[model samples]
Target: MYALGLDTTSSALTLGISNFDQINRYQTWDLGRDISIYLHQYLEAFLAPLSWSELEWLVVAQGPGSFTGTRIGVVTARTLAQQLHIPLYGISTLTAQAYAYACSLSKVNEGELIAVEYPGQRGSVYGSLFTWDASNQTLSTYKPLQYIDLKGWQQLLSTEEIHHHLSPDTVEPKGICQAMIALAHQQWQAGQQPTWQDILPYYGSLAASPPSC
Candidate 1:
């Protein structure tokens, strides 16, 4: 089975296609503020290798990333899923970042928590905690994504003993999309079919904390 993942939650437009475990194609475009203008254009070309009918489900980084970027990506995903009559899976931007960060690590102490943070709307940073699964190469959420200032975040990290903190700046869009697809592919394989109508993006200020799922 094949699936598609799009992450326009950053200035970069990241897209990927995967067949269960392995990603077949992945690309990232640093489109700055013009992502909305070209997302569909590049997406169409990115998806040219496979027929839409071949896609099992659609996946998107429903964020706590860029406000405008997240909205654009989710709306496009919902529309495509609606038209294609397929399920749409919303992967947390923080969750994807955790996975990508895990992949970047040379050695991850499996049970130790890895924290990911993104700059938020009003001077706070969005943070989420996750535990890396070395054997499975997967991640399990330790805490739901939430918004907090740097000081509060530091306190929380100390309280939680989360040693591995990953910066949002260091991650590449390709890694984000890869992680997005992997998360969705796992859910798809498990036979959880969520509708596109229910899919929504998580933006800070509006929704400070959302369930990791």
Candidate 2:
């Protein structure tokens, strides 16, 4: 099965294509412009060497990232999924990042994993904690934090037995895409392929402590 994953959660645009267990291609661009414009251009360029008809699924990093970026990615994924009549799966960006980190630290003896993403205007970050199970190739969410205090990093550390860290700084598109593809394949095998509407991005609770520019 062929799966395509897209992540436009940050200033960078990341795209990945995988066939079953192998990643065929992956790309990341730091396009310092509107996401929609850059995304379209990037997709067009990337898709030129491949045939969309060969794709069986589309995976997207459902937000908790940039609000505008999330919208652009979801909208694009929805449109493409509809046009292609393929299954669409939404993976939490934070979750994917955590998974990526876990894979990188597969040799580590013990520790908790944390994934974080900038929430743009929210003033706080959206993060999630995960316990890595290397043998099962699973990273289970220990706790989900929609808004976290940046200054309380030490406090956050105390809340969990995190001997290791996997923040956004360490995550890469290749890892995110691989996780998305693995998830999509698992869902497909389980006959749980989701519809387009169900693949929409998730923006965490909208409550606010007004953002500081």
Candidate 3:
């Protein structure tokens, strides 16, 4: 089965094409322009040589990242999934990052992985901690997403046994694609198909920065 994944939920724009066993990815960061334009160009270029009709699944990073970037990626993935009549899987961007971190840590050592993604707010970030099981190739105890202040981040860093870290600033599309493909396959086997209307981005509730005491 062939799956296509898009992650334009941050400063980076990632496009991934995977065939159950292998993944090919293209990512560019620091696209200081309209995200939609960059996403369209990348998708078009990436899909130019292949027939979109052959894709079996479409996966997207449902966001807690850039508001505009999340919208651009979700809308595009939704439209393409709907048009192609393929299953759509929405994976949390933070979770994807955590999974990537877990996979990396599983290779070199044994410990917990923490994934953090900047929420594009004044002084807030979104983070989740996860434990990895390399023998089974699975992740467990994924902590709920939390909105953390800079102080909270420092606390997490000092207190948590964070062996590996994955952030948008350091995450690669190749790893993201692999995680998405694996999750997509699991969803497909379980008969879970996501719809365009059901896949929405995660925008944290923080109207304004908390005032300092």
Best by TM-score: 1
Residue 15 lDDT, candidate 3, scale 0-100: 76
lDDT per residue for candidate 3 within 1-213, as digits (tens), equals 678888877667777787756456555555745676677777878876778887888888877777888778888899998898887888876676666666665363444565455554778777666666777666655556667776787687778766766667565756775676666667788798876667766666543221110
Our model 1 lands, by Cα RMSD against the true structure, at: 1.8
Q: Which candidate do you rate higher for lDDT, 2 or 3? A: 2
Error of 3 at 146 (Å): 2.3
Off by over 4 Å in 1: 21-23, 207-211
lDDT of 2 by residue, 1-213 (tens): 678888887777888887756447888888745777778878878876678998888988786667788778888999999999998888877777777666777574444555454543436566666677767677666666456656554467677777566666676667776776666666688798787877666665563321110
Residue 74, model 1, lDDT: 93
Q: Model 3 clash pairs?
A: none
Whole-model Cα lDDT of every candidate shown, in order: 0.84, 0.71, 0.69
| CA RMSD of all predictions | 1.8, 4.5, 5.0
Better of 2 and 3 by TM-score: 2
Native-vs-model 1 lDDT? 0.84
C-alpha lDDT of candidate 2 relative to the true structure: 0.71
Better of 1 and 2 by lDDT: 1
Question: Which of the two candidates, 1 or 3, achieves a greater TM-score against the reference?
Answer: 1
